[model samples]
Target: MRIDARRRAGLRAGGVAAAAVLALTLAAPATAGDATDHGRGGQDRTYSFTVMGTSDLHGNALNWDYFKDAEYDDSAHNDVGLAKISTLVDQVRADRGARNTLLVDAGDTIQGTSLAYYYAKVAPITEGGEHPMAAAMNAIGYDAAALGNHEFNYGIPLLRTFEKQLDFPLLGANATSVRTGRPAFAPYVIETLHPRGGKPVRVGILGLTNPGVAIWDKANVEGQMQFGGLVETAKRYVPEMRRKGADVVIVSAHSGADTSSSYGDTLPFPENAATLVAEQVPGIDAILVGHAHQEIAERVVTNTATGRPVVLSEPLRWGMRLSVFDVDLSFHRGRWSVEGVDAQVLNANTVPEDPQIVELLADEQATVVDYVNSVIGTSTEAMSAATARYEDTAALDFINHVQAQAVQAELTGADAALPVLSIAAPFNREAAIPAGEVSVRDVAGLYIYDNTLLGIKLTGAQVKAYLEKSAEYFKPVTAAGTYPASALTNAPTATAPNGTPDYNYDVMRGLDAPLTYDVDLGQPVGSRITGLAYDGVPVGDAQEFVIAINNYRQSGGGNFPGVTTAPVLVNRQVEIRQLLIDWVTAQQVIDPATFTATNPDWRLTWMGEPLTVTP
Candidate 1:
């Protein structure tokens, strides 16, 4: 999972060379246009075209059920559904005829919500079964789409069957067959569009999944295939596209752009790929990106050598926004060059829903509604799952306490009195068990990823290093501060206004033993951790203690140091969700007042003053 920085540097340097060649080949002075202008230059000789893209649909075919209501409400705020997208596509096509428009998706279309879960479990797309996503995409008419990492969640055989149901081609330049050495899926697609009274223009579309797919879903994809680098694959395919009579090349990249430097074993910056592809990929005019669930429009990436503009666009997730890129291509000197380019974000809420697509999703809608609405257990008092600032939640603390106790019992024959601690991530604080009937859906909020429990032995020094690594997620208040503003800020400053900290940038669970140290936000990897101790005692570097955490952390999910090398004490067959369920069942009655931060060793302060925590 380690990203070789040298490899990234080499790729960037290669991009410069490729950009130089592309500049010489496509050197032509051309006019520009705006939202009103249809072409680049004078008269009606110019060919105008539009590319529409969608990403991270996540199987939200219906509106979001925030209240777990049986009936869906289209009028709700940000209620993004595929039906709305269908309507918007129709309207756009009607406005700018089919000949001038191309529709594309950036993947992650088959997972996330209850609808997708039910679809995969109840009536999967097999030899004789029907896939609703295929039918929906066909109804709306997609030109091509890239394969997302999540597509491999069901394995290759089922994926091939799912692909068979779609009318449009699935593109993935880097994904190749293990046995044949050729592409397992279509690498790219060339489409010929003829504008009114104008010559036909060929558009080439290439697809790429995130390169990290190998690690994310290794069990499903590793044996059958290998995913090549996005930049390298695009460089290989773009020239071939042009040789095959394609006038313009566009990359439908499932990888997203990143501007942060928090690179580690798990989190990777796709900006490197984006920069390399834009500069190196010959004939590529624009890139439609996804997988980050971020909203980007009309980012002008300059080719390092050529200085030409490569436009990039990404409209948020779940059918919320449609990215529209207008490009004017003209044939001169027996070759087509991009004359003008502009992009915009089309709001899904502004358009009316299409009735036909709604009817198509009716049965699927009822199934999801019932699944989320079915009650499992009830709580006498509201058990708030919220993770307070510099503090843990009662729900998560209780869950971790159970896991820690379980680990201790398993390791020491149920009679040992070692100070056992369990680690739990705080990002799973979105669900609240209201003072009423709690369902299986409510349990999903406490433990989302279905991670398994893992017990390992770690010394106090290693535990402090792990905490320091976790603290790296936040920005320090000073040159030597432990807390991030998102974790400890009390009110609006010149910086953050909302006063509410980001939940993801909190202290690491466990490590309740106290210690004092200076934290450097900009410290180099492996050096950020120092002044390590546990329980007012300078812990011996060789001293080992049993630590409890989920299987993800055990397998290096969050990039915690020394975790992968730790000795395994117990591999609990039960999932984290099952553990939470069992614990809740054992407790029966829930109370929010009992919820308190168990780990007192973790603390955050701003400018040497301790920040207040609000429940």
Candidate 2:
């Protein structure tokens, strides 16, 4: 990650000019909604246009669930993928007419499942090869798209391959080349809409991505690409879009709407800043947000500078929902003026999968199915990840075990001496390893995300701080209420505040210690974790330890304190899934007794005033 010192110096040399250019370009503009003012008698022509946006598709092109190893169907009651989204796209385009509709995605299309992994890691995008994702999006006729942080997961070379294959431009205004101080991709795209009996409507789309990519993809982008803050990038580009004669400006932000800095405010970049960009930047007409999988039908935020409304929408992940923005434009005095704006969601499940998309990607889908279903190992009994949130179940421990063993093997004598703990979260509640033979699909289901493992050095106090933050996943319990009943109230998974996803709630394994903690309803969040011990010994500040964690946490993805800058003891440079497959093949039989030899490694309990664990 260390850039060449000379290159670093060179960047610093032009830093002042870059800053000046940014300042000079971001001059405020007039309010967007005030383009036409007063007099109903003088009113001019009006026309309707529709904008459709999708985000976090994550390579789900077929109506097939990789985990189930079957074609996704309504009987199974799952949302499925892009093939289904095409159905909704057809409906919207038909209703609005093909020329009046603009379809765009907010990134995260290439790194979620075995489908994407196969293209990037297995078969690979060769000179003549066609990536299923690019083929599907091209078939769906996307106008433009934003780059999600995951776009960098397979490194720049693969991303470039996918980008070139796309018929539409990939917009990443903030993802700039450190060497050039310019955008790595197109900053924004302007699509002029042709409305009947009115001036052509110039629609501008500016894409912003999560700043967390600088950390999450540090291995791939550290010295290559530098990411600027979303607000800063938006400020620099929104004005340019307006000056380019854009009647409507839509921001396709691959970040979340949450404005608070997840990794503290010290750094210039904030991980999720769509809300900040919309509020601060004046000319935004609508915003499509992603990288946070939560769904929003539509929300309008008033621009802080102009007091004009900025409509926002987030389609749920895996192409289950499409965010639709139907805009009414009043064409007056030879220009298009904003009149009314609205946003809504169209369910992909409402219709059947598009046969054309399914037929196009059928081969790649079958290849991935064969790839993920290959047998790896055997299990004594059926294991389910469903209850890992509540109990320190074997399903989660199995992953921790594999990760810990892999980390242990990678370390030498001295590095191994420090008690190692591997922290992991149960990402899939429905994932299971059925009894008997275990295939790659079974293991993939157990660990759903595409995160690589990193073993880092941590002091006992840092470990405590880390777990305390994770403890925020639980709601506090009052002593007066019935004990366990009130305790597990918010214990249901995915109850994190500020729209934080629950999969980030991590638990650790190693040292044969249970993560026992009590939350006092009255106490502050940072103090929630107590009774923290490693092998019956209080894990104090002085004790040193080696901890294995996913690259996401190590990248400060969850805003976990002290993690982003933590010293890396080892980088396996291997995907945890392959590591697990290797571990499973070596072990042959995965018996529950092996992992359950020790007591539960973590517990999120409830307490009241004076916070004490009940007997």
Q: Which candidate is the best by lDDT?
A: 2
The residue ranges of model 2 lying beyond 4 angstroms of the native Cα positions read: 1-43, 71-78, 376-397, 404-419, 424-437, 448-507, 511-538, 541-615
Listed per model in order, the count of residue pairs whose N, CA or C atoms clash below 3 Å is 2, 2
Tens-place lDDT digits, model 1, residues 1-615:
112224323433444211211211111121222123234553335566788999888776655552345333444456576788888887766666655678899887876666665566546766466566766776777777888877876677777777766656777777886777677777887776655444567788888876656655566776688777787787788888888877888889887765321123333334226656787665678888787777887787876656778898888888888899988876554455688778887878777677887788777677666866666567766655565334545665556666776677666553244456667666544667778777656866766564657677788778777766665554444443344434433333334354323432324333344344433334543454444555656667666667777766776665678888776666533456656655565676555444443344444444444444444
**C-alpha TM-score for every candidate:** 0.68, 0.73
Model 2, 11-102: lDDT tens per residue? 33444212212111111121122223333654477777788999999888987767677766454365768888888988877676666777
List the global CA lDDT of all models.
Answer: 0.64, 0.75
The best candidate by TM-score is 2
**Candidate 1 minimal-lDDT segment of 10 residues:** 20-29
